[model samples]
Target: MSQVQTSRFNHKKYQSFQQSMPALKMENRQWPSNSITQAPQWCAVDLRDGNQALIEPMSVAQKQKMWNLMVKMGFKHIEVGFPSASQPDFDFVRWLIEENQIPEDVTIQVLTQARDELIERTYQSLAGAERAIVHVYNSTSPVQREKVFGLDKQGIIDIAVRGAKKVQDEAKKYPMTTWTFEYSPESFSSTETDFAIEVCNAVINVWQPSADNKTIINLPATVECAGPNVFADQVETFCKGVNQRENIIISIHTHNDRGCAVAAAEMAILAGADRIEGTLMGNGERTGNMDLITMAMNLYSQGIDPEIDLSIADEVVATVEECTQIKTHPRHPWFGELVYTAFSGSHQDAIKKCLSVQRDDQQWDVAYLPIDPRDLGRDYQSVIRVNSQSGKGGVAYIMETGFGINLPRWMQIELSRAVQEYSVRHSCEVDNETIYKIFQQQFVQANQNFEQQYQVLGYEVHKQGEQESIQASICDGSVHGETQTIHGQGKGVISALSDGLHKTLGIDFQVQHFDQIALSKGTNSQAMAFVQIKINNRKYMGVSEHQDIMTATINSVLAAINAYIDAVQ
Candidate 1:
């Protein structure tokens, strides 16, 4: 075959071809009233559309992996590939059925132009499949006649009728397997609507659609000529005009040329489309196909079950990127890295307040957010970040959630001032480590030796074989300008500290809970301890830091005692 045979029509001519259509806008698109009526079956063109768009199309193994993922995700109908175009595609379909890899419930579809040799090969590829759909299409637009293929409308119809008869004849050989016939009027969006309906209606009569298993008429707004609503109008008009409604399944295949493929699809469904055909993350030729993941999850957020398992959408996209060498943007809807992240102060403040409210009711009541990120397997940490655009509530929430520190209103205001400045210097994405480090530097400090005031330099305890008491020796700065060692026995470290202080200075405090956490990763990470103590029924909190948890606990107890003494003095 010459290069001209494989070549597509010029882009300029397609744009010029669209000028004959009506000019329309989709400024205020509305959601469908009855979301439940929306069809659940998705005919994923990932292997054909997505694979072809790759810089290097997938190997047979990679295509099989993608096919497996599609079947696993509950797609009964999948367009595997255009088998007539490449030997790998033919081999893949043959291998799938020959190995019994094609699931029983799934019906694999293959694409072919309206040519006898190609149609025969398309049939040859599906010989082993228990169920298959023969998808045949021909270019029906006027531009193909005058500019590209030099074929008139009648000539195109003749080719289509011949293809339809060939498919019908082949179905007789496979008596057990159910044969589905699908026809697409290539470049139908830019084609004359009446002509498209005419050609499709003729194919419908030839294929003989029925009430039980209707022939699917896939009307692709192939290049996305206008806004989504207009496409919806176009689809509604076609469904209304097409003969034998009960005998036809109207499907929509939209490209994202104007970035309205998703919108177009949703609106088309509202206008009565029975099936959706697209690729994951809109990966295909040009701007790619409509993202079924985004579309399904979009309905999911609206409290509608799109009936497709999208929980592994991220994994599928990652595998596609690896296999195809195409990258998914971090800001892509649903699967993007920063889609759930909020750095603006006001946004974070609202999220924090909303979270506090939601905790009480276990329901969402927030501004600018519809569904919880956790519903999509995302965490709450990235929902808010401190930045120049941040508000005071965000800082307070971070302090309260990330660390156990709850600042007073006055302190919160002061901290917000510092946070705003820091946010201006570094972009708004302040990580958890930076916030913890900053809190430590500003309020807590490391000290080598305590200046009297009940210092706990070191401590050791010995329990003699399940005895009721523990003996402890605590080393602290002595009153006589020396390091003094004191011994006491109690139930635990807090009790031991209280007993030793009572023996030395006649001051005592009740021991409370000692809370500790490993502050960082790795074996050398420090332990942070918070000790709560009671003196005359008045509670005081003291925070301590040390590499060893035991030492940190001792320091926390001593710090609490010193705080009590300072309060009294």
Candidate 2:
């Protein structure tokens, strides 16, 4: 081992892995030309790998909960636990078998070391299993062999061969159950490529696999030491050198020591790896294992079927957090709370523009959004949040989607300024309900400080053919809403009300922009009226909601008039 000195850092710990490990000699790598066009055979190692890495391991009940969720998520191959290592793990395996909770299509897997007692106990735990995999491993890397075990190459080979034989012998006793054997040269990526092939080949020779009974040769980057490209090279070389290609399923389990676990896994798939072993959200030792959620969703984003049920992303994150007791980072890829949200001014503007023209039948092409949030049971309400960094488009989007008030461009610009000022003053992001209150205070009821206001008491409209007449009682902004009767005639009820207001208020203004829509879906009874008027060439708007559309229209006219009155006085 070598150490170096640097002024900024202790460059000491570091020399590239090339110094310690033999460099892979594959000039003609084939993985670079390949792309991940299909999903691989996925096996979830949550129960074993994910559980062991947790600070506090999951209870039996928690383990069962996770197991059922995995089954629900369409995981056909699940590594249940290391049955021989713990009594609870052994009991859980027995519970699955005795209670018949294992689905026929799903094959539960258990792990063991090369020792005979654990190997036999692993088999005993799978006594009545319909189909199960017995995964056995031994460390084959140079460091593990020389420093940890103080063994030569032949010693590692003998351990793997003996473990394979013991596993085969145990399977013969449980003839009623179907068994699949798996071998991992633990820390396979850190081992010399040729030596790893030798150990796995020795194990394969003992198992004598066939086309019908394929053995899984899982090559894990147990401690990731190289870049994804280098790992791809290793995988390609192993796939080419390994024997019994047709009778072998080349699998990979990668760690995130270098923060490239998912990338390495994808590259390995291109290098002819057929199956993948990982935990949900990449839960494992050290930097954790490859994340199956990210891997599957990556495939989904590329239009490939992931073969897993990932419709409710929240459900997956919640379940994993509960079992692991590890709170997911809010910025975790794909499933985090803020993953799909945007608060940047430019980003929000672009997202709102792209989403406005998006159609469900068309391909997703929204700017700043890789996939539709609705695909994961999330509405667009959270897609654009208004903070100090937000823009008009985001404010308008939140208002329209969250509260059913679609602001026009000018209105969006006006209200967004108010929202920005509020956010800056309070130094916090504004939530939806708070934004609604802001809209109400600023636009709909701008006369909140006015001592005198208009109130619509009651009205009657008599329609004779196309002409109409209205008789109404209204308060003229007096101290106690003193009642006054007014009458007017016009072609419609709206015109009649306007004419009556013109006579009673002693002020005249034409409606500039008026629109109304049902505030809630399914019925038009609950309606909101938007009325805008120009006073002295300046625009003022008012909004009013009521069970009766007629009352809403009358109140909105009064509200706009009152806003104008406040401005003038």
Candidate 3:
């Protein structure tokens, strides 16, 4: 009673598990040597699996919206729903058939269990469908067979064969419509490859498919129980053993329980799968299905057309979010809000250099970015965000892209330090507007605190022969804040202004760098001037914006003078 020691803490209480799923026992497996050259026929299961997994299934209107979006994305085969399992699903299928919302080129696929009654009801829901696929499934894994259905190997085979027969019989009744049959030995990932081939072959024999009406043998990694390589082996084994290879479409439906659905789908394709069934953004049960968006973009990044139009990825994300009520994770591949953004200093610097170069072709060669964001309807402004970790290149990118101000190399370093200080003080990301404001406060408005000093009230410049004369009026606060007018002659307005300031207030500086550009376009467009001046071996920068170029230049020089005075004082 004082101290109880229990044997439950011993590791021997748990049984040892298999290190890996059994590898297919063939030395001549071709899948490992093959590469995916073309895209497989795509089938989106969002309406069925994706919808059923939702906490609140999509209403009829929402289903219609999703259906329209899929059609627009050019899906030839779409699994509308498991009509026999849900009333709304049945009604949605009937509505599509009756209202003729189903396009002639598109074929609607509906799912059903192995039971005869559910197969009959599934066909009823698709009675008037012009072209449809009847997908029937029965679990075949040893655990599902014994624990879920309490059936042996022969018993499971009977269920698949009977379901295939019933679907073929019902499809024959509709003489005017084109019908395709798909059979899934569900949970094929955990099933013995030999037994899975037997059940699928039995279903194919009952369906009696020809090349014109090929049967789809969908092998679902329904629970994703193994690594991608093991799943690929399972597919290779089934493809090798299945009879009538040309008359069957070997399809793969993968889940993401182990976060390997995309990898599994790609491996299955390499293993000779002819079709892929998945949903957008991987929305489904458990960890969700393989993300068709990721898979398609992966193909695109490799110079292969995924055969789906993803130019409007933002719209696709918006529609899916609205229908599913699930916000896309910010780090989701290709489609997330922040996938393309670079917060690291080195990454931003590399990206800035890449974007600055002009390419002769449409090749995307940017660093740290797999695809051009512009290709996906996103602009380059949001690619680099400023934080405490930001560097000169990232800050310069923001200024050039966001505010149209191309800061010089030296100014970039200067502004980056200010921005980093601001970010550290606030402990958050600095927005574009805040960055612009900081720039203005540092350069353009540097003289606000020294307003009582010498201020340029007005300035006029005139050129004569090779000489330019500038007459400037200033309020000199150092001289009891009195107003004084001074004149000087030089080669340009900037030169003349420097001479005038030196004569009026004994302030002398040499112009190091001067640049100007129109801030915008139009008759009323303003001009921006950037001036760097060296006073007593110390450098200072100033910026000014005004309607007149001469006035902006003068203001910039005066602001630089005040900044230099403030520093020395």
Candidate 4:
């Protein structure tokens, strides 16, 4: 018996998110009425935000590979690095500019803290770019303001004001390059809604952004502390209170600390945010950023063009794994290798039926799959993988699709049980080839699966009117038992074979079922036969494939007789 153990830590020490974060002051929120109909302005932050979260950060080569991959995926704005903090980041930025690597259309962004020298260093890194966004941020949550910075509300606002002025002064030095300024009230979700608006407005006043020359006001859920609805309320309240709402691009940067980063980002978008900042595969600090891959796929599933190419999703995920030195979980959403694969019996059965009626000209309406996996370069062959948990429909689908052998209902039931036993015995999923092999060895009696007590050698059938006669040669298990022929007469070849088996073996069993199908569609097509017998009210089944229908029928009955004999012994 297991003992009841109490938890060691005290749960009373924790506070609810509402108690910790400041309340919103909106009289009537309008975000609930909104819905996401289109993709937002996307900014890839794999290098800046994602890199900082890595325990062993990407090497220069890895960073370059990741950068090139991001460009190819159609990201208009990519936060390349935190040039002000890391020397490697500074050098990489310089390399992009010096080597003419920045594309004419793409805008590379860099991040920095709201400090004097770091802000200046950030500008230095983007020296010769045609256009760039200099992102600056400072923590503004209640805990961060009081405990970390030991600053009052006004003092925190002053820090942001000074940073904004310095950023404006530095941008004047480079008149040739187009500049877009971005400021973040980091930890915005847990900060007072009115206070966050005030800081953003203060920064906007210094920059004086206009409709023609826009700037970004990023609000980061640096540590997600509430539900998506609460975050949406905070965003809506900020959008209403902030200055120059038209000029300021309300961007959301979310962390998955509470696993609601994407949910919050989606809600914030409905709350009037215009941009999203995230990393590929959601690789960032803690639980990582909202997975851009999942978000993009979500949009794609909804018939919205994500503006990013995911056709080579399998290849892209492999590259991300290689560069990050992290293996994607097989069950990870969308991009995982096995997310499109089904192992459960019900899931596989539904997927098979849906796929059979699916057409390229029509909308995707598969039962288990939301989107056609072929859209992402995945073949349908991997859709329904068979395992111990799989059922007849899955086995039948695999048999027909993989080997072109259509299994009848009764045969599918028997084959599925054989597959389950084999899978359990091997302690793994039974692959397509293995499923076929199992059928051949266990049912067809072709692979010497076990010491068969009755092995069919050959058979000849004679038909007159509706009556039939069969003479089958089989090796009955005994000391020096030679191949012997047994003769029986019945209404057809199948009944004659059953009659011969029961008379020879002295086991009275009724022929419960019989079936057959062509292995191919030509004159040289092989015949596959199946048989089911009931002895002592217990059913046994068998199968065989051969060029001659008579031979296949004979072997199939003999296989069933062998199964019954083995079970009785």
lDDT of 1 by residue, 92-164 (tens): 8888888998877888989998888898888888885788888999887777766888888888888889988
Best by TM-score: 3
| lDDT for position 503 in model 3 | 90
After superposition, candidate 2 runs with Cα above 4 Å error: 1-8, 452-569
Clashes (backbone N, CA, C under 3 Å), per candidate, total 3, 1, 0, 0
Flag the better candidate by lDDT, 2 or 3.
2
| lDDT (tens digit, per residue) of candidate 4 on 375-453 | 8999878888888899888898999999999888888887899899888988899999999888877777542343645
What residue runs in model 1 are displaced by over 4 Å at the alpha carbon? 1-19, 23-40, 359-363, 406-410, 415-428, 446-569
RMSD of each: 9.7, 4.7, 3.3, 3.9
Overall local distance difference test of candidate 2: 0.89
Candidate with more favorable, higher TM-score: 1 or 4: 4
Which sections of candidate 4 miss by over 4 Å?
1-8, 25-27, 446-509, 535-538, 561-569
Using lDDT as the measure, what is the rank order of every candidate, best first?
Answer: 2, 3, 4, 1
Encode model 3's per-residue lDDT on 386-457: one tens digit a residue: 899988888889998888888877778888899999999999998889988899888777655574456668
Candidate 4: global Cα-lDDT?
0.87
Local distance difference test values of all predictions, in order? 0.76, 0.89, 0.88, 0.87
* Sequence-dependent TM-score of model 3: 0.89
Best by lDDT: 2
The TM-score obtained by model 2 is 0.85
State TM-scores per candidate. Answer: 0.75, 0.85, 0.89, 0.88
